[model samples]
Target: MVDDTGQKQTPNTLEEPLDLNRLSLDEQIYVNMRNDREFQGRLHACDQHLNTILGDVEETVTTIEIDEETYGEMHTSTKWNTSMLFGQEDGFVLVAPSLRVG
Candidate 1:
């Protein structure tokens, strides 16, 4: 198919959306989860259901609260790292170019 840049783009033979994860094997990826939780890690393994096993993982959790006095919203983010992590299919996974590393 022709892209906006007038360049030809070849479509992948992915049967389903999750099939995109196969291309990210052994690569760094990002996962955005519920409750303001996020993950960044190397894609060690993944399944058809989008469940994944990651290595060298970093997890971030953002908590939002309101100040009792000012009634203003306060945001706090906490991060930690682990040697390995297993993530359920409860969120969205990202591959290269979209993966955020910091």
Candidate 2:
């Protein structure tokens, strides 16, 4: 869903997880800010909640060992303004002034 600022909020789903491993460094940080509980019931509500769920973040990097031969990493820096929400589409849809994460 798109907000007043034209920012999009993508809903999360059980079948699909927010794969932090696929995200880049900047994206990870953005996820962190999005998933902050304190920011919930606010503009970044969905973002914060999802980070709490799927983003195994520490300091700046969220690591994933895909397999014995393959691994993935997500690193983040400063947070950015609410622009888009990336995740699965199942349970929720963006309803302005009342956002749901999962």
Name the best candidate (by lDDT): 1
lDDT of 2 by residue, 5-93 (tens): 77675642122333332232233332223232111122222342443222332323233334445554444344223334444323233
Clashing pairs in 2: 25-75, 34-47, 34-48, 35-47, 35-48, 36-48
Candidate 1 per-residue lDDT, tens place, 4-65, comes to 68877566435466766876788888888866888889898999877889899999999999
The positional error of residue 27 in candidate 1, measured at the CA in angstroms, is: 1.0
Judged by whole-model lDDT over C-alpha atoms, candidate 1 comes out at 0.79
RMSD of 2: 15.5
